[model samples]
Each structure stands twice: as C-alpha cells, then as structure tokens.
Target: MSLFRLDASILPGTSSSAELADLVEAEWTAAHPGAPVTRRHLGTNPLPSDAWPLAHTGNLTPEPERTPAQREAMALAGTLVAELEAAEAVLLAVPLYNFGVSQHFKAWVDLIIAGAPVGSPVLKDKPTILTTVRGGGYAPGTPREGWDHSTPYLRRILADVWQGDLVIVERELTLAGVSPAMAHLKDLADDLHAKALDAAREAGRQLAAK
Candidate 1:
C-alpha cells in the first residue's frame, strides 16, 4: 500500500501538520510494515507559490515558456498530481490560518483539483484525513464557533478530487492568552495527538484491507 503525506505548514521545523504526519506515519508503518510512504512538505520547501495565475489562465498557449519560478511551480503541480495518482491513502494536515487554510495549502489544492471528470477526479474515491490545529477551539455548538472553513472547504474539494470520505480532527483554543473560557492549548494538543493516532491506525487498517 502507498500513502501520501502532504504537509502544508508555513512554520519551519515545528508545524502541527508535521507533528501529525510524524505520528500518523509512525502508527501506519508500525501496523503495515514495508508500506511505501511519499512525504511532501510544501510549506518549508515549497516548489513555487504561483499556481494561481497559471491555473487560471484561459489560453493553453505556451505563454513565452516560463520564468524559473513559474517552471518550479508547474513542476510542483505535476509532482502533486503524480503523487495523488499513485497513493491509496492521503493525510492532509492543514492548520487553520485566519479561519481557513493557508494560501500555500490552497495553492497545492488548486493544482490537484482540476475541473475535469464531473464525478471522478484524480483524488476521486480515495480516503483522506484532514487535521487542523488552532489557538482556540471551533467545535460545533460551541460559542465563538460556527465558522469553520477548514474542513468544509476540504470536504468539498476532496469530494471533487477523490470523491472519498473526508475525516477531520480539529484542535482549537490550544494557544495561550485566549479567554480562560477556552481549553488549555497543551491539553488540546495532547488530546488531538491521541485522536490523530487512532484515526491514522484506522486509516492504515482500512487502506490495507482495500
């Protein structure tokens, strides 16, 4: 079985997404030995953050070749598509930024969610897990909540790509300096890690069975 881990954290060295990937990969590898894993860290070593313009262009003309940056951006896009095509399970850790996924993460999605195949997309029918970490909690029914664009957008996008089941684990109000009403950040992080491991194990078992 093949698993693709796409980490979209702008922070260097210590991103919540990276942490989840580490935990998920460890659990999956322990459960499914010899399974191949392809990890792509987009935030730290991004290919290029200019996919918006290229993807939106109406004309298919060569457009004067491309600058170095454009070329890298296209290559990254191709790499992402190829990875998606080969993987059976995908784990996307998208920490919330300003109530939504970071622009870098969105750029990666733009490259993969092509507007073809009304029902079956490259990501079509693949199981995907989306994990988010925030300084505060945004669980449904909680006060100061109800505006979670992270998983909602991902659900729609994943539906278009793989048409697969999308799972989300959200960690909110985990940072310091928020109203005492919010949960402790450390405790939330701990709990989130545990839940993420469980989800990863299940994901591995499910994918292996398939």
Candidate 2:
C-alpha cells in the first residue's frame, strides 16, 4: 500500500499547511516504515492553467479526430486519475489564498473530474487527510465569520464528490505572529497552531490504522 500526497502551498518551504501535512506524513511513515510515498508539489511545479479546459474538451472529442494538444491533455488527466486510483491513502495540504482555493489546485481538480466518469466516487473508502491553513480566524462569531470559502469547497470535493473517508486538520490565525495587524491575537494563534498539530498526528494515526 502506498500513500499519495499532494501539496498545493505556493510558499512550499514555509507553508503552515505543509508543516501540518509533514506531521501526518511522518506518522504514516512511522506506521509503515518501508512504504513508498508518491508526491506531487503543485506549488513548485504548477499544472498549466489551460490544461483543464483542453482535457474537458478532449474527453468530448473523438479519439481519431482529437488534436495533438487535446490528446496530450487527455493523457495527462488519465495519469492524474491513475495516481489517485493506485494509492491506498491520500494526503493533501492546501492553504486558503484570498479566502478561496488556489488556482493551481482548482486546475488539478478539474483535470481529475475531466478524466473520471461523471459523478463517480474515485476515492471511495480511501482514507484521506486534508490539512487546510487559514491566515485569519473565521469562526462562527469571529469578524470574518462566513468569509472562509475554502474549507466547504474542499469538503465537497474530497468527501462528497470523490467519496473519500475524509479527515481535516485546520488551523486559523496563521498570520497573527507575522502580521502587525494581528499581533494582539498572537497567543490565540499559538493555541490554534498547537491544536492543529495534535489533530494532524491523530489524523495520521487513523490513516495508518486504516
């Protein structure tokens, strides 16, 4: 059994989401000492923005009449789907950018959908962990309540759409220590960060157990 990890943090090395994912991955590696990990870092090497549209259209075109670009895109989509299909478990680290999902991640998702059959549960029963980091607090009573537009969409795609057995490790106020405007909430941010770390480990243990 193998683990497939996708990182969507543009910041990569300094990404809070990736830091949480590393914890989860470490646990998984500990549980399965010799298992191989398949990784795709969309941040460092993003997918072409237009690939999704080409892929979507490629699926509609006849194999014999498809253009070279269309055929190539279709093939790329197939490869993406193949990775998900081959993995026993999956981990994704994504950050909230501009209160929404990153454009790179969006392209990846669209390509996957284009490759798979309509409404199909590609990850049905697969244990999946999604680590999502937010720069600001957006809890129910917070000033930015309902301003978060990333988590819900993530849940919909990972759990509802792909049918993965999803576990989420979320941390907010990630910028409290770095943003002068959020300095007053630094302590709160630290607490949230600690909680997120604990959650990551637990999620990893569960993934390994499964």
Candidate 3:
C-alpha cells in the first residue's frame, strides 16, 4: 500500500515530531517489506505564503478565464491534493510552534481545500495518523494547560474537514531537559516520549494491516 507522509518540523535532525513519524514509518515498512512512501517535507519546502490567497481566487474564478498567477496556484494545489488522493494512508508530523499551528501546515491545508471541488472531501474516510510533539507540558492542571492550539486545529481538518479516520500520537514536555525552565519535568518528558513512540508503532502496524 502507498503511504503519504508530511513533515512540518522546522528543525531537521532535532525534531521530535519527525523522529516519532520515523518510528511509525519504520513499523509500516517492516510490515509491508517495501511499500512505497511519498514524503513531503514542509519544513524545508514550505508552500509559498501567498499560495493560499491565489488558490482561493483561482477556486472562485472560472477555469477558462483564470489569470496566470491563479492558474499556477491552482496547479500547485492540484499537485498537493493528488498526493493525498494517491495514497491509501497518510501520516502528518506536526511540531507545536509558538503554542499554535504551523503556518506551513495551515497553508498546505488551505491549498488542498481550495483545490478540491466544492463540498468534496479530498481524504474522505482515509486512515490518517497525526503525530505531534510539544516542547512544554499542556496537560490539565499544568501551568500551560489548554495552551495547545495546533492539535485541535489539526483534528478539525483531518477528521472533520477531510473525514479521515484520524489517530493522534502526541508527546509533550519535550523541552524539559533542553530548556532550563522545564528541567524539573525531564523524567516525565522521557516517559511521555517513549509512550508516543510506542503508540506510533502500533498505529503504523494497524494501518498497514488494514
């Protein structure tokens, strides 16, 4: 089966979100023994910041009368949507940026939505795993509780908008050992990271089996 993987970690080698996604991909590879993987690294090759507006305008304009800029934007959006449409399963690795959604990921989503026909879901009923890593704790009762805005937004898009069967594997407190202010939560951070990896592996296996 084909798998589409999207990575949105700004930091290449040091990103927990990417690492966790690797674990899931590894598991899937082990199960399929050579399945094709389509990778899109938004961190390094982010969609143009203006692509969204152009896509929106293109979607509104009739195809025969579209401007050159609008045509290019629509073409790019079609390519992005094609990647999703061609895959049997999808994995999105998103790292929390400033306690909010990654602008790159959001831009990608906007393009996909604009590229699709009105009222149609590009990823309808597809199996999707959203792997996320947060630098700080945002659990209930924590100082930064409710601070996570990315996860919910992602869920709304993947599960609600695209109608995907979504599963989330999250690891928080990732900055415990790296950031001086979070030093006290190092042990918990490690534990949470371990759990997220384990969950990712399981999710991959299950998706591959399906």
User: What TM-score against the true fold does each predicted structure earn?
Assistant: 0.76, 0.99, 0.97
Using TM-score as the measure, name the better of candidate 1 and candidate 3. Answer: 3
lDDT of 2 by residue, 126-175 (tens): 99999999999999999899999999999999999999999999999999
Please write out the lDDT profile of model 3 over residues 1-210, one tens digit for every residue: 899999999998898998888988888888877879999999999999999899899888888989899999989999999999999999999999999998898999989988888757777989898899888889999888999999989998899888998999999988898899889889988889889888989988877777
Clashing pairs in 2: none
Q: Whose lDDT is higher: candidate 1's or candidate 3's? A: 3
Q: What is the lDDT of residue 92 in candidate 2?
A: 98
Task: Give the per-residue Cα lDDT of candidate 2 at 94.
Answer: 95
Cα-based lDDT for every prediction: 0.66, 0.94, 0.90
Relative to the true structure, candidate 3 reaches a TM of 0.97
Model 3 bad stretches (over 4 Å): none
For residues 18-128, could you state the per-residue lDDT of candidate 1 as single tens digits? 665566566667767898888887777764555646644422437585665555555555667788888888878778778777788887777665323234477666777
Cα lDDT over the full model 3 = 0.90
Q: In model 1, which range of ten residues has the least summed lDDT? A: 111-120
What are the C-alpha RMSDs, in order, of all predicted structures?
A: 3.7, 0.6, 1.0
